[model samples]
Target chain A: MASPLPQLQPEVAEKFRSTVIPCRIEMPRLGLTFDLRTLTLAEALELMKIPDFTYLVPRPKRRKAASSSTSK
Target chain B: MNTFSLTHLKGPQGDDNTPGLLGYVLVAREDAFSKIAKAPKTGTTAGETAIITDNHTFTNADDGFAKVYLTLDSNMLKAAITGERDGRGLKISFEGFHPGNNAEALEFMRIVKNLGLIILVPDADGTYLQVGAEGLPVEFAPDYDSGKLSSGRRGFTVKGEAYANGMYIYAGTVKYKA
Candidate 1:
């Protein structure tokens, strides 16, 4: 608990209080690394259980030219 | 009579707590790293760097960071904190002005517009005033203005804002190599 009356040293009380507060900012010194190996390992194992050609996904033919056929 | 204690918030008398930052700044893109596998090490209690090695995964092969230099002007570059932690995170706003209006100046302005950025501001001392935490970053750009005849000055101010944590201090130079 703070005192009823705050008292400061004579020198301190004499000086002007110009922007005297300290820095309140603090960084949370921590970063994250994703474990893709562990996450995809389960999926990889699950893939091994499936037949080689269980489902064939049909994709559109690779377009040689972009939608626009204008000059390069 | 008695006195109250203002522990970490205030320092002892005669300590230098001066305000304002230097004119030069270091900036990098957010995606410049695959991921910061480790947080950058700050040397001081207030989070500054020391002579020790840095810890991080700065994965950018080409664009590590660009040092944007500004003329020696009072308060040329600055960073400010906003918002509170009542379930809402903080925000940071930075504005750096360079005195010029030529095409050379505008060339840099064109690139930073509306892109996520990482800013590192140096103080008069060996510390840095930084914004945008590791994973979270800021969006920055510039605004050009040619001053009036009375106090005419032609220049551009790089301004940006983001919902960030708060400002930080780095004791020494920043390491860009992963």
Candidate 2:
């Protein structure tokens, strides 16, 4: 997946750190549903200010869809 | 039925202009309150605890939820104000990932998106409701590797303007059905 930052305006990019990001991720294999709309460690710290947000630790990747469905 | 009237209070004085709060702290406001006289109604065994009211059902989406009622009584108002007595606070919860495991770069954006929940705290004196300001508690745990053991799930203890001074959290057994 490509970085969505390119889709945001410069001002929005700057404010992105403060505003809440919205999304809901589902991992069927684990029967887990993570509500990304809520705050996270990276959002709390505003990692966007950092040149490389990766300076922060990485979390497990979302397991890919088994059947390749657009909507989970 | 944790309900309270809206009362406006004076904000802290300073350049910040934001209601003067020291910081976000998770004060277990519920603990301080007197336990309900009646035995808390433990709902059926479900993954999440919930309160089903005539109008709505507040369910703890992830963790166990509790139904605490905040009334307009003097004591309840006192508890809300005390939440802010110490400072501002918020509740944070997190999970996933093994610490220091050089895997693919974790999208900070994704984490920020996933691990966040907003809390709405009503003000004393029945004026307005404050949400997404004070710190409550954060529960998180990173993946454990070969007993490497990562720690993230931790609750915060805070009191002040952010939590205790004018905040009342729900208490007692979470009701599943109204």
DockQ per candidate, 2 decimals: 0.01, 0.01
Where does the lowest 10-residue lDDT sum fall in candidate 1 chain A? A18-27
| Per-model i-RMS | 14.9, 16.0
Best by TM-score: 1
Instruction: Report the poorest 10 consecutive residues by lDDT, candidate 2 chain A.
Output: A18-27
Model 2 CAPRI quality: incorrect
List, residue by residue over A31-70, the lDDT tens digit for candidate 2. 3333333435444255435442221233345677768676
Per-residue lDDT over B1-178 for candidate 2, one digit per residue giving the tens place of the 0 to 100 score: 2223333456565423433222111112222222211212343333112221111112222222222222222111112222254664433221222223233223322242333222223234222222222233222222223332474422211111223222223322221211
lDDT of 1 by residue, B23-138 (tens): 77777777775543323343234322222223222453323446677766534443344555565556666667778877867887887785677666766653565566556777
The CAPRI quality class of candidate 1 comes to incorrect
